[model samples]
Target: MQSKTPISDPTLLQLPLDTRTLTIGGLAIKIYGLGAHSASTPLTCIHLLHPRQQTHEYMTGIARSLLHTYGTQALICASFDSRNHGARTTSPLANESWKGGNATHAEDMFSVYHGTVEDLRMVVEYLGVYLRRVVRHFVVGVSLGGHAAYLALALPRVEGVVSVIGCPDFVRLMAARAEGCGVDVRGVFGGAGLGPIVGRLDPAAVGMVGLREVWRGKRLLALSGGADGLVPYACSQPFLDEVKKAVWRGELELDLEDIVYEGVRHECTSEMVREIVRWFAACFEDMDGGSLKSSLAL
Candidate 1:
């Protein structure tokens, strides 16, 4: 689903900036563009997630970019530290992979991201009440955050997801990593292979039949790096292929746009950010049945 057209540099729309923080159910959530003056208005909230070992501050620039583009439209951007990250850091070693000496790398990473999904669900459930306004939820995740974005698809409130360098097949990715790291695959995947815990949490383990129900009516824009050595695109291709098949067969009504940038690495490039902004604009247009050309105008 790579785009044939050339991707140009993004021209950000500069607007008034408003930043604030709230502690919701023990999670410190940072919000941008939604202030006391605008809390009563209905808005769409886009949650931005950072990469592994990074804090919510890592997403500040992108949050500002999104707010500048949609702030006037009652759109707010929010972000929070994932489990074992930022303010939630309990054991830094738990964040590392097998190569970094984490014996239970697979379970640790999966739990962190899966727990993030649950945290998001709780935030979404209570956010409206706090603001006293109707709120819609969308998510944009990068690297480790991207993996969480896939799991967030199951959330009833999340309508769209933008995954940058994320993998859907956690078991495959972990198996490959374990092999390369000289760690016993059995230790990671277990003696039975693809351990019960991973099978229960991994998105690819859900199978296409289950995915049909989870992905229906959702919008996904997956940006991958073709040469990504860390989270290789190959690990996710099989699942993406099945997703496309389901869509083509009318079994899943999903708005899926998966693109691989040739020669790119695991990093999120400026071009990827541009595509994300454009995709968000397009999704907003589709939802409202109105043009946002002016909002995106340079």
Candidate 2:
């Protein structure tokens, strides 16, 4: 693979794990993604979480392309089924909220975070131990996967985080959805003793409160499409605003470019993909003071 252009390789590798089942807090979960790592890799590891209800192949391919384009070779990409979205149907709350639980949706989300962070932690630990490599690990996610990425970053292993088209205000979105369904959102989280819990687990709230402390001096990037409707471009704005006025203030920058390809929705676009690749490439490539190009390798 040359540094001049990104690789067009579609070949992906699947790990030879005995089992993909992960048990956390008495809750079982499944992971359906790639675990690709070559011998003698570097420390800057990448953990990519896919969108809701997406396959591992799709997510891993995107991650691989991003890594290849960025010239960041020290990376390992992994994607998993959060709950009842994929091959984890045996688990409770598959494709639905927790049944008869006091907090319902909030509890479900909590379970997801608890389970997901643990899975990611295990992967990082395994790579560090078994692979005998990796020092600086970063996480990137999109949509619901973006929230999971934040959760993983909150864990011990993750060093930095990149959230793409993810809404940090989980409670707010659920509340709006509840209203759309004619259900009282406040009653759901509040009545179920989830309001405070949500305050504790909400990504936006967490980012505002202690994320800076946890990720102090760490590079964080919030990427989103300007015309995104599903996750809303507004979601990333408030956090950027809060961080600008906060304790961990530094050269933190947020990229707000929207790829306007036809029929491109909340999903990843070729331009967006190429931009990510170029950004990664710029990080490692010797630029020789030349202006970086604004494009993707579609």
Candidate 3:
């Protein structure tokens, strides 16, 4: 918790990247990647977000690690800027993309979540054209970016998701903040209730609550801090409970894994990052030749 600086994986820095700019409806996207090993391997995109409270350089090392590990014949790992974060901040957010984040801190945070998810959507679509032979996509996001990862799973193109210190139930999150932190519910986010907007965007509504097929097929790994005072575990506990219930009934094709660092706060530890890299890498290693390959874009 003392450092917001991302620990550099020295070896990762040595890897070369294929950097380029792609226009998403007049918005210039700056993205960099490292691999496309072959026709058999498709890219697995990782979307990252840097909210106001966090360090801007937070995801760089993680991106590098991913590129080093899966950017081979196994996947194509890439990172793009969300609106107002990196290269796209000057591009504009109100005109055509998301208009959600311009208010208060919490409102802006949620807006960033919405905008970044859409940014990732555009990036994924662009990648489909840029890397045509690629397979399925996987997303790993932290904090606000974590929200984007959950939302991305709703897309048919995305088969896997990793959400760290993020919440999907916007209503519950607000409720928790109101109760735990004593914020006004009705005026919690910029004096406008967040319930309605969250309802439309919450991943819980899409994956759980009986979207049986998507729930069974999509692979999800949720990481949280047991002592997270920011976005308390109760905010996501209900959704986690639902995922478990579904998996318990013999409905899941892949495991829905959730890990909480007992005393850790709302932050990612070094071990958590390593586990994320390993877990994502494990996705394709089983190589039944059919499951992973078929999971990619065929």
Candidate 4:
């Protein structure tokens, strides 16, 4: 089933800096304050392949940056753990028959992705309800979380997405994972027919093709580092190609852009955060050209 569902039994407690902690649909999430000038709605951040602890500061910082740039209360920010990653390191489904029934680790990753897509949708829907406002939503994700951002694009409310160091084509990512350093295939992957395993579970085949409809009026910013050893430039080609197609078709007006940090790799630097903050600002307004250039140049 698709992850799209109404929020259930959500409980939220407001804290300092306008942030809050809430649990809904069995997931725990953090919400940073709404932008000074924004509605109670939010831009959600999906963490990397890891859990929420590692990237919380950076993710919340993006929300804070948006608040500073837009100066509007419309841009609230949020984040949550991916399946079997951070706090929920022991996902119930991870041990279910469907998880490892197929013997390839790439497929295992797909299983995780499937669960994450659901988790994200649940949270987005829940937040919409909890805020009790006419909320507009945006998403940003890193690594596997970035891929989740792409999937979230299909949601009607998600108007913009920033996918950092992530790819839309799961097939390619699976191949890369299959070849990651020191992968002992004889045990987890069952050691045979690696190529065929990822083929059956291609995210494109699973559900990404509909991004055409989902992306009709959306904006996307894809960031990659040139020297990165993992998730090399090629892995992002499919997402770039999709963006190019949208721009050529006039389906996107603002933020149809991509950037590569020649010296950076696998990791998004503080400078990248500045750039993303700028990209989001462009999405909301035609701000002064002077500040605009500085955000992108960082």
Better of 1 and 4 by TM-score: 1
Better of 1 and 4 by lDDT: 1
Q: How does model 2 fare in lDDT?
A: 0.52
Per-residue alpha-carbon lDDT of model 4 for 1-298, expressed as tens digits?
Answer: 1121111111111223566777787677777654343454333332222222243434555555555555443556677766666566664444332223433445455566657767766765666566555445677776666666667666665667787776777666555654654444445434554344433443354433434565655677888778766567677777567667656777644346788889777775666667777776575663234322222111
- Which model is ahead, 1 or 3, in terms of TM-score? 1
Clashing pairs in 1: none
lDDT of 1: 0.80
Candidates in descending TM-score order: 1, 3, 4, 2
**What TM-score do all the candidates reach, one by one?**
0.89, 0.69, 0.79, 0.70
Better of 2 and 4 by TM-score: 4
State which candidate has the highest lDDT.
1
**Which window of 10 residues has the lowest lDDT sum in candidate 3?**
94-103
What is the Cα-based TM-score of model 2?
0.69
RMSD of each: 5.8, 8.4, 4.8, 9.5
Winner by lDDT between candidate 2 and candidate 1: 1
Q: Quantify all predictions' global Cα lDDT against the true fold.
A: 0.80, 0.52, 0.64, 0.56
Model 2 C-alpha lDDT per residue in residues 1-298, reported as the tens digit of each score: 0112112343423323312444444344332222444556544556666665453434555555654454335444445655554565454443343233333555565566556666777766665554455445666676666667666655655655666666667765565545545556656566656677667766666665566455544445556667665655555566556666663355333222322334445666545555555555543342223232111100
lDDT of 4 at 254: 36
Q: Which candidate is the best by TM-score?
A: 1
TM-score-better candidate, 3 vs 4: 3
